[model samples]
Target: MDPKVLDQAAERAGIIPEYIDAWGQRKVISTETKRQLLNAMAGVADDLALAAALPPVWVVREGESAVLSVALSEPADWVLTEETGRQHAGYLSGGRLALPAGLPAGYHRLALRRELRHWSCQVIIAPPRCYEPAALLAGHKLWGATIQLYTLRSQRNWGVGDFGDLALMIEGTAKNGGAFVGLNPIHALYPALPGWASPYSPSSRRWLNIIYIDVGALDDFQQSSAAQQWWCLPETQGTLSALRDGDLVDYAGVMALKLSGLTLAFRHFITRGPEDPQRRSFEAFVREGGESLRFQSTFDALHRHLTLAGHPTEGWQQWPEPFRQVDSDEVREFRLKHHQDIRFFSYLQWLAARQFDDCFQLSRRLNMPIGLYRDLAVGVSAGGMETWSDRTLYRLEVSVGAPPDRLGPQGQNWSLPPQDPNVLFARAYEPFITMLRANMRHCGALRIDHVMSLLRLWWVPLAGSPQQGAYVRYPVDDLLAVLALESHRQQCMVIGEDLGTVPQEITAKLQAAGIYSYKVLFFERKDPAQYRAPDEYVPQAMATLTTHDLATLRGFWQLEDLRLGNRLHLYADDAIYQRLLADRQKARQALLDALHAWKCVPAKLGKNAERVVMSPILNRGAHRYLALSQSALLGLQPEDWLDMALPVNVPGTTDQYPNWRRKLVREVAEIFDDQGITRLLREVDRLRNKSADGQNSSPRPE
Candidate 1:
């Protein structure tokens, strides 16, 4: 291919020709790789003819009063229709058309006609920035507990943590003056194939994960004879007990138990008269869910059907052509044949949504300030429902990942497809808006994972190594505008996960948009011996000592992560491992010194101590230290409070480590009942209040 043609293709496809690496080195994408990515973007076709025949999608700010330019071969009459169906007609003169400022802020359709030659495009009007809650901007220091919802073990739940556990946890936290409960992404995962249980690798971000539904919380569950009989069985009870007692979550077993009970409940509900009030509510839910819900339910039922018929269910791409396309006549016929099964999945969604809403209501009743904070993953899995339902929006040939850095020298491929920016713009960003709104529902705050993706993403071709990838730019202004609009509409504070290989400009942009930054204590220390002063931390940030991806406070103190990494063969060599160990030792000693200086830990605990062990004193001290920060939001992990040694997830490895299945050392009841844990939380609450009142002492950096 000609270099000029490739350059033009890259420009049109929004592929960045060069980017600054993590080490601040500028690197150029290979010519061949650029060509491949552009081809994967479907931009190599006869674009000249298509471009000449069609008008490109246009975007304007809500109050910009902008004019749109169209390359017209002849004068044409234009008709513009707002999303509300209000239409405006005007005659196109020359090639430019002026738009009225009175147009509402939404997606509007623009149609051009001249001598029967018709063309149409989408015009998006977006707000300037995301919504900023008044409480967040009021300079209040609020504290919350972040937990992997599945790790929450409760007596009432069958095996996995459910909405009931969340409700109970909220009550406990609120009693101790907590403001919110942070959770991992609760996006929809595969119910039929329960073994595929990575929360981040979800089937659909626009729906709830049905596995979190508490069967007993369903309206007719207790009244149903079938459900009661199943729950009363000795074998079923034994299975639930075993799952709850296990160290790792048994996703398949738990899902089986829950599904059996849910099926019975569904049967019992359907037996009710058609005009029952409960039945009407369910129908309304389905109607409101509309096509997205229908597609997800159809995909779930079809996958199960295919699997039962001895066909592979890993991905729809491997299915026969007719069954692959979601809109195909064959797929529609199959859905009709298995309509009952599809509705079963839809019912599960309704139950999950209802249960989650109950938790939100309970939070409100408890008077928790922020209520619940939900996480939003960056992208969906490659063979997931979203990809199958809308193939045109994603570039399946390339994977989204991070380039080689200090953490992973070989680079990291998340095995998730990146959205095609061009296609996303062409669709008027309805999918993006829908996803934002879905996640923000029934939540006070939304945490966006890898928020930098809104501006650009590293697209690694599947056939090449991650190091050979290129950064692809997106319509950042448009996306941010939509996010602001959704945030305002939902009244949810937005927290952007702006860590790792992020540009400084991105941080500035996020800060200006009233989005909170995520700051981990481990990354805040400038040197091994000295942490950043508490007063130096950003005021508009969520501060934490560790994250799910890193070692807990106990693990960090014991250096268990290094040992685990060595056993898992994550280090490049023994030398690198030894270097990391030495660094950890220094950092540990520095932390001990800081704790002594701050009087967080007992001053008698030697400042010169060579090593710190996992103890209640040290764990509580860590929490207190982070609570003293100037950050407006403080998040504490229950695993750290319980002194759990294992990290929830180990980056750069999949099968080698139980990534997301580790259960918390203590159950929900035990955690709430532990006096020591309660005392520590109270101390955190006190310190947070002191900070909010501006009565805390200035940080004494050691």
Candidate 2:
């Protein structure tokens, strides 16, 4: 192929032909890479709808009129229908039409008429920026704890954390003057395939993970004699005891027990008449959930049915002929025969949703400002219902990943498929919009995982290595506008997890749009010891001591993560292990030096880096230092308070180590009731209040 032709194709497909790596070296994309990527994108790149007479969608900021371009040769008549059904008429003559000024910020419909032909376009009027809570703007610095919901332990919980635990944690934390609680991505994962437990790779982002359902809290558990009898069984009690006592979550065992109890509840729930208040509420939720809900329930039912029937194919892709697609005749026939099974799954969703909302309300009643902040994963797995329900929106032949960088010399392929950018625009971003709306519900704030995705994503051809991937651009301006519009409408704050090798372009854009930047203590550093000072941290950010991806404070200090990594063979060889050891030693010394500089080093155990253990003072001091950060939100973790030394996840190794199964050392009630933990949290609250009282909290570029 001619070089010019290839370059043009790359440009048309939104591929960046060249880029700089994390090491500051300029690397040009290879011809073979371009060929592979172009081939993967061919299905949607040259989409006919993208080149229609008028663009499929138009984005106009509020308080302004945007000119719409069309393909008409003469004057055309136009009608702009507001979201509320009111219409505004206009004329087009200069090959463009200026949309009516002062259009409300929403999704609206516009139609153009020229002679006997008519054209339609979706219009999105966006706000200038995302929502900023009044209290934040009024200078009320706040603090919160982000946790892996499954890791939480409590007296009432059946091994894994449930909605009941969340309510208790929220109420307890709020009583201690904490402002909010954060969670890992709680999106739906496969119940049938219980071992596929990573929250990042979910079955559907729109639904709840039924594993977190507090089945005992449901009315069916109280009303049904069968459920009560099952709960009292010796076998059931034995399984529950083992799960609760173990240091790791057994996803399979937990599901088995929960499902058995939930099934009894569902049986009782179905016995109620449709007109009963509880039945009416469930029906309303089903109606509101619409096709998306039906798709989710149907997928779960079919997957479960096939698994029990000893079907060879677990994923829908391998299902025998007719059951592959979501809307196939065989699937419809299966649904007709299994309507009750689908309804059972739908009942679980309703129960889970109600419990989740109740927790959010608990935060509100306790006067917590940012009650619940949820995480949204970057992409969906290839076999997920998100793709099966609509194949055109995603290109499963290519995977979204990161290009080679220092940490990962071979780069990383996150098995999640990339969405077709052309389809996104041509469909007026309905897929994107629908996802945002669903996540924003029942939360005061939403954290977007790997948020740099709004600008671009590294797309690796499935047949190629991660290093063979090229960058694909997205419509950042339009996406940000849409994000801002939704944030304001939902009255939720947006936090972009802009960590890792981030591009320079998104920093200013995120700040301008009022999206909070995520800053981790380990990464915000000038060197190993010269960490980013508290006063220097960005105010429009959520400053945290650690994240789910990194080592906890205790693990970092004790070098437990390095040892664990070595055991798991996460490092390549002995030489790599030695280098990590050398680096960790320096890091320990640096942290000690920094703590001494902060003047909060505990007297009993903060003497020398080599001799020091992960003592209470050092642990508390780590959080104390972060609490004094100029960042508006200071996030702490429960692991740090209990001084635990293991990580919840190990990035590279899959079966070599149990990645997402670690449980907290203490239950929720015990964590809050402990005097030392309470003192640490109360100190955080004090520091936040002190910052609000004309302290160093001010927005700055990170």
Candidate 3:
């Protein structure tokens, strides 16, 4: 092969020379062979070159032939485009498509119809126009206390907490002199399979999870005949009473009873019919969702088929020839037979949306500047509903993940096939815009899981180790523009999870764009006393003591716990880990000394866990907005929070751990009402009030 051509191919693939040599060395191929290889990768080559050609863009030129490619085993049904205006049916793999010939030379618009799986870019088939400043969506700040919704058990609740629980929690927080109530991601997940639950790994970013719907709390439920006849089962009733007194979330038991009630409620909804207001709203939501409803239905049908057919379902690549590709007629017939199931799926989404809107309304009622802060995951699974449904826009052979960083030694493999960057730009970036719009709906703020992905993604080839990945860039300008536009439309603020090895330049870009970056107290302690002081924390940021993924405050202080982590298969530098251990011990001792100085602890109690733990040196990393997780505030280990042996999410595992399960201990209500926690909360509130009024100012320790 011509070295230069190979070099071009490698560069387009984002492959470094060392890797190329490692993978390709000793392989023999002639110049003719090189030409064929380029042809084979022609579509991909063009996309890579175009994506690398400029920063992420939205405008392409008319009359130019921009090859459209699909990211799947094969192409999709061509007829699918007519129904949805999504071209997912046509190019599941790389192929050239001439841009509609000749158009007015300014910005024109088009839409792709594959719901979340489609991407399109723009073609400028004309002379370059003057640059214009991009507009963005405006969002508000929400500073409030948070308790997981499912953590609360109330008289009205089933076995677990629900939206009503959240409303009550927010009300209580407000009564206690708090402003807001934050919670975990509440995105929709597939409901066909009963307990496949995790709020973060959502089935659809476009909808809410029905699992959170307050079935018994609904007005209709009150009017139901079933309520009049209800004599609860002793065991179930006892469980509910227990939850009503608990302090943490019980996801397993909650899901079981919630699902049972929701199933009944869904039936009731259909049987009773919609009220005038509900009918109008349903019509409106349907109109807005349009083809998204259809695609969702179709995906639901496919999902059911896979479930029934059993595991692996003949990997898309290995399926029978006709059904193997997305565009095949067999797939079209499959959709026809499964149309009802698909429609039910769409109905489920509408139901979830209605409840989600109710939650948002509750937030607004409480005067929260931002309510229902929604979270967006980094990407979807490769062979999941999204990839199967919108096969046209993905690169099935490559996956998205992180490069080697402090979080993971071998980097990380997320297994989510990313959109073809070139196709996204050429098609007007419809997929991204649509997804943003969907997430922004009824949200006070949106938390982007991996904000850095807007700039670039670490692309790993299929079956390749994360260490062998390369950085594939995205059009940051256009991506940010879309985010800004959506945020403005939603009237919500954007909070980027800009933790981890975010490139230094990205923070400035996010700031300039008015997007807030996360600042966790634990990570900020990298320099101990030099970190942002409590008084110096940025108001623009949502300050937190720790995140769900990291060690809670008390967990961080546990020397034995830290050592246990080191012993785990998780990667960490031995030297750095030991140094950190020593530093932590010294800090703990300093805190103990400070407690002695303050006389808050008797000399004997100075060595006590609680007293020694409260010293200034131990509080060295407290920020302006101290977001203490319940677990951290209680000084319980992470396991205590989950009421389990290990953390709910092991950062770098799939099969090794139940990463998204492990519920919290007790109910959300009990957490607030517990005498100890309530007292601490009051003290914290007092400190916060003093800080706000400028009366709590203390000189810098240095």
State which candidate has the highest lDDT: 2
Superposition-based RMSD of candidate 3 using all C-alpha atoms, in angstroms: 9.9
Compose the digit string of candidate 3's lDDT tens values, residues 313-408.
Answer: 323443456655555788788878766556555656677677777777877787654556667887765544556556667777777776555446
Q: What is the C-alpha RMSD of each candidate to the true structure, in Å?
A: 2.5, 2.3, 9.9
- Per residue, candidate 2 scores C-alpha lDDT tens digits across 463-548 of 99999898999999899999999999888999999988889988999999889999998887788767777777999999998888
Runs in model 1 deviating more than 4 A are: 44-57, 62-65, 72-123, 320-322, 697-702
Worst 10 residues of 1 by lDDT: 44-53
List the pairs of residues colliding in candidate 2.
Answer: none
Worst 10 residues of 3 by lDDT: 629-638
Better of 1 and 3 by lDDT: 1
Error of 1 at 316 (Å): 2.1
lDDT of all predictions, in order shown? 0.85, 0.87, 0.55
Which candidate comes out best when scored by TM-score? Answer: 2
TM-score of the candidate numbered 3?
0.72
Candidate 1 global lDDT: 0.85
